[model samples]
Target: MRRGVRTEEMQEQERSKSGLLLRGRLAKELGQHDEAAKLFGEAAALEEALAQAYAAQGISEQVWRHEFSAAGCWFQAGNFLRSLELCDKLMATPDAPETLRERARSYAQTLRERRDRLWTELLQSEHTLVAA
Candidate 1:
């Protein structure tokens, strides 16, 4: 109930949100897709909680980063089909920005191509090994 306590809580909450986003970004950069996805999911959850808090406080913009995190998770996991589906869904969602949608689309396309090429190479390698 103390004013100083409330201020401290708000600051701590902001720091927590920022920390989650930073951790997720770092994980993704390190090519730790599984870890990145978990971090992103955690970040998204925190953002959703913050959004709900804002809504309760009568704020218009409930800024949640779930879509971006989810899209990144799918892309990082090499689940190109899922990534594409999510990208399309996010594109249609009013809360998702056009820039985010475009980013998702780009990532989805890249993942799909990469997955296809990798599979083809793997098959060829297996065939060669069998013959040998």
Candidate 2:
């Protein structure tokens, strides 16, 4: 009775959490950076929970998919380090689909390149400012 009620409530919470991912995407599309980041963070947490559940059930495909999604969301949220961490995890996941692993590798390379380019731009800007 009480346990059943609690389970229902928990399920409802999970459903609400899942909705954040879609909302985050919408916010991102709208260029609402702060809101998008917050929503994406919430959604990433839910994705992680889902990943754990899938792992418990021995569902490797779902686990990797959720992990990849969460990583992407973190990247969109400007959490590059976290995104890279998850990307590395995806790459290291044994028995994961080759396509997914390749995607993770590609994403990691892209992120690194983007970071390096941004760093160079920042340094160049700073040098110009110092010269002035």
Candidate 3:
């Protein structure tokens, strides 16, 4: 019974995660950037929570996978710093899977290359935030 319940919970969370990602993409495609960002952030939070649940169960692979997803969400939301943080966390983990570390390294490199453009966007948003 406990196992069944856990499976159900995981399935439900996966469904929700998928929905959020789809909705975020749609919003982005529709030019609703702020809405897309918010949706992506929500997706990231959900992924992080799921990662914690997996960690509590000693599911190392799932934990890193979820963290990788959360990083992607942060990237979609233009939260470069947060995305990079997750990538760094994965890369720094001695016990992390080799594939995960390699992926993170690749992602970190891309993030570095886009840093200037992302920084400009951040500065613009900052001004808008300050004005409002």
User: Which is the leading candidate under lDDT?
Assistant: 3
Q: Which portions of model 2 show Cα errors greater than 4 Å?
A: 1-14, 129-132
Per candidate, the number of residue pairs that clash is: 0, 0, 0
Score every model by TM-score.
0.50, 0.79, 0.82
Better of 2 and 3 by lDDT: 3
For model 3, state the Cα shift of residue 18 in Å: 0.8
Q: Give the per-residue lDDT digits (tens) of candidate 3, residues 1-132.
A: 012124567768878999999999999999999999999999998898888777777778888999999999999988999999999999999999898899999998999889987788999999999999
Alpha-carbon runs more than 4 Å astray in model 1:
1-64
Worst 10 residues of 1 by lDDT: 1-10
TM-score (C-alpha, index-matched) for candidate 1: 0.50
Model 2 clashing residue pairs (backbone): none
Q: Give the least accurate 10-residue stretch of model 2, judged by summed lDDT.
A: 1-10
Best of the two (1, 2) by TM-score: 2
Question: Over 4 Å off in model 3, which ranges?
Answer: 1-7, 120-132
Name the top TM-score candidate.
3
Q: In candidate 2, what are the lDDT values of residues 4-109, reduced to their tens digit?
A: 1224544564686679977988898998989999998887777777777666666667778888988887887778898899999999977888899999999999
